[model samples]
Target: MTKPSRTYRSELRTEQAAATRRRILEAAGACFAESGYGRTTQAAIAARAGVSVESVKAQGPKRDLLLAAFEQAFTGQEGRQPLAEQDQLAAAFAIENDDAFLDTGLEFMAAANRRAYALWRALTSAADSDAEIAPVLDGILARRRKDIESAVGLIQRRGLLAAGVRVRRRVAAELSFLLSPEGYQQLVAESGRSHREYLDWIRSMVRATLERMEP
Candidate 1:
């Protein structure tokens, strides 16, 4: 049996979908970058994407929309996949090997800083709880934690981690620290350290912690 070829119009449709999704993400990232989390809205993201508000809504509700935008910006990929690899997750977190831990973690903090704070505030305040965003937010955090595991594994592999670090305990704690939005608000916000400085400390602290636990 012969397989049917994709019609030209069908191919065009696929391309258009790709472009639309990209536009939504780019606009969301730009808006979030400029306005912080509290100010950005679906209408704003739609305008940024050059689409109707309905289109943005159809693309996703608030959680999905934000997740889509952040994932794209962080990983250079579509929404989260089930079995993602370490290097890929690292890329999604915007960390390259060329980036020192501080530099890479700092970039991620900048991208996530406002959004994380805002989303958390929303979770606590509105509806007396987050009706929908909680799971999405949790998923994002889980992924980030996994990225730390990947990074810690790399450190261990290279023997950059100290001689006898306990792998499981260190990875768990480091993940908790890196994934905590409260840490961001306290250190990056109230502590008066610049986001860059705090992130550097996070990297250094995590590395030091992990190295100390090396086995």
Candidate 2:
């Protein structure tokens, strides 16, 4: 059946908006990655995008900053699938890349981890005493959940997730650690493994777990 005209236009508009948002996000990501969340201000992010501070604020409120980034980072896999729908097992199997599915999957996963970790560290630290920062922290976490849920849907469709494990709970934990700058930095500071090596270990372990539960 042919799709509706309005649907197409709506998609086009969304694509445009997303593109603009992505430009801003990529810039913000670089800043956050380098400066840590506490150090990077919205003005710096706007400068990276060559836009004004007000434009950045208008583009999205500070609370929505990470949300915008998370939305852009993942390819919209709203990967949640009910366990009962074993028929759509294909959803769980991600990354049809020639470069080893696990490797590619973890590459994106690490990217997501870095972004989320920055948000988490900033929000959590801010929320320690300031009540105003509470909502911003919640907003960041809410977006992360949405993205992970999308990933979970893909896993359910492909049945690639480990069996017998609580899907939502497991995804949440994996995402939490995978994109955790704090955890990554801690491991780096204490364990002496380079970032590249640490990510490899992470990717391998996550994939192995999937193989055990779903393969």
Candidate 3:
């Protein structure tokens, strides 16, 4: 029997490494979400992932792990890329119908909230007292605002934005405030609203904002 080529072996190792890294990040996210960042430990994450503590530490320190896990949960990747540029939103961005685009955008927001809100709540609490985590939280919020602006720009380009919506920055800020993870945490996680009810609230608030801007 012929042996596998060196190049094939190398590729297999790379895929395995990527899979291991993803597993560790996922475990870290779950730990942070359930235990909070101050309480979560590398050992705990390793136990959750069924890997060694050293392997978890090999990914990064706890702060890096929290940020990476949050990013991965939020954007489906551990990077600083804007949401407008992410591949996950490509199909939604390509929708030419304004109604369809709005629907897709809301669904995307709902899905993202479902995936990341718990971790986001953990991150928010960590930022309150952890000096190392505060800046990271600021950066995440900044990126979120920029993403809202980008979405507004896209809507304007498609001629879907209302004529009365003259101040885009203000509009973006309103959207950011309205769609904050804190609100999601309160309404869905703490207040015991079902996911569908939370989504309906989002749709109502967003539509009300848009309606107010209609000329």
Relative to the true structure, candidate 3 reaches a TM of 0.93
CA-lDDT, candidates in order: 0.62, 0.59, 0.85
Model 3 score (lDDT)? 0.85
- Across 142-170, the per-residue lDDT of candidate 1 in tens digits comes to 77676556555565655556433466446
Candidate 1: residue 22 Cα off by (Å): 2.6
Error of 1 at 96 (Å): 13
Q: Where in model 1 is the C-alpha error above 4 Å?
A: 1-9, 26-41, 82-128, 162-166, 178-182, 185-192
List where candidate 3 sits over 4 angstroms from the true fold: 163-166
Ranking by lDDT: 3, 1, 2
Error of 1 at 91 (Å): 7.6
Alpha-carbon deviation at 83 in model 2, angstroms: 16
Give all TM-scores, in the order shown: 0.61, 0.53, 0.93
Give the top-scoring candidate (lDDT).
3
What digit string (tens of lDDT, one per residue) describes model 3 on residues 1-215?
99999999999999998899999999999999999999999999999999999999899889899999988887788789888777757788998787777877887788778889999988889889889999878888888988998887776677656533455676788889878877788888899999889888888887787777653
Off by over 4 Å in 2: 1-19, 30-42, 70-103, 114-116, 129-181, 188-192, 207-215
